[model samples]
Target: DFFWFNPSRLPSPAEWVNVRRIRVKDAVDPLWWMSKSAYPKANNRRVLEKYSDSMIQLIQNGYKAKLRPSGWDISTKFQKDNGGAIPPNLLQIANTESNSWYLRECARSGVRPHPARYPSRIPKFFIEFLTDPGDVVLDPFAGSNVTGEAAEATQRHWIAVELRVDYLIGSKFRFIRPHPVLAVPAG
Candidate 1:
């Protein structure tokens, strides 16, 4: 609705595979998980239970616990005191965005930074989130095959499909060294 040039059209959008169980030791811990802390929320369950064991606990105990403004602890803001890991934005006090969060990474010169293709981090986030090592990720509309590169980076197997041969050919650059030098024929 806010497009200035293409006012009639739209602008967009990861690479998430369907959910699966975690059976491998190498399952991804997520960038956020790695960046901050993971185990901190464990004590939250105990805190809620400590309020009391009766249906009338809130009425009886005077509500010792408090919920965040949104009242959904999963997107939590409660104080967890069990020495667990801090949340994703735990360290960075200033970077919180008001609307939403997006993961971004530098793209290769040509394969992405374009409307048609996506940054590898887009695929990287999902590959790490939904699957483990050796899990298979399939991108039906591969575009420049960013998902394939992300899969390889995350140690997951990947399958890509792009109807255009030129895209497929260009996609190969993703696997190559960032910059390569080829020799010129002798004149």
Candidate 2:
């Protein structure tokens, strides 16, 4: 993530904040055993660039992957209805370093903001990539239940647990309708 955002700071970047996002998923379904690395992205550009500097540099220089793997050998071996999506390991999210968005959302919904919370995109990305409709997503260490919001938005069942009831209650803002004062007028 760091390398992708700041390619100029290569070799050894001082960035370490994004390293905290570690997700583990279990594909208990027997059919998904063979495609182990299919959804769970193992590494980011930081690690990949370190492992293969020249290879990643080629893309950094200008090269881009084929929009779809069609006509490629891999496409022949494996294919899915969502094959058009080229899953990228490197994530580029802006304004996630702060909970400003969450705070604003809380105000709009007339609720308090949790002191600490992750962006909904974090869980939304993983949930969309790893699970299908109606799957259950569990956030064992749910801070403000952002994962639960993402799961609910994606039409999945979710269970979120937090040490404090206040924080869990604050997460309800994610589901509450925005106040009329904050709603934008139709153009």
Alpha carbon RMSD to native, model 2: 12.0
TM-score of each: 0.42, 0.48
TM-score between model 1 and native: 0.42
In terms of TM-score, which candidate is strongest? Answer: 2
Name every residue pair that clashes in candidate 2.
none
Off by over 4 Å in 2: 1-85, 96-102, 105-112, 178-187
Runs with alpha carbons beyond 4 Å of true place in candidate 1: 1-64, 67-77, 81-115, 178-187
lDDT of prediction 1? 0.47
Give the total clashing residue pairs for model 1. Answer: 1
User: Candidate 2 residues 1-187, lDDT tens each?
Assistant: 2112322222222233234434322211111111244565332221222324544445345444454656644322232222133435554443244445556776766776776454566567667766676977878777778888899988999988778776777776667766879997989
Q: For each candidate, how many residue pairs have backbone atoms clashing (under 3 Å)? A: 1, 0
Tens digit per residue, CA lDDT, model 1, 1-187: 0111222222221113223432322222222222123443222221122222343443444434655588754322223333333223111112222221111222323333224554454466556655677977888888767789889988989989889876776677667652335545559
Q: Output the lDDT of residue 70, model 1.
A: 88
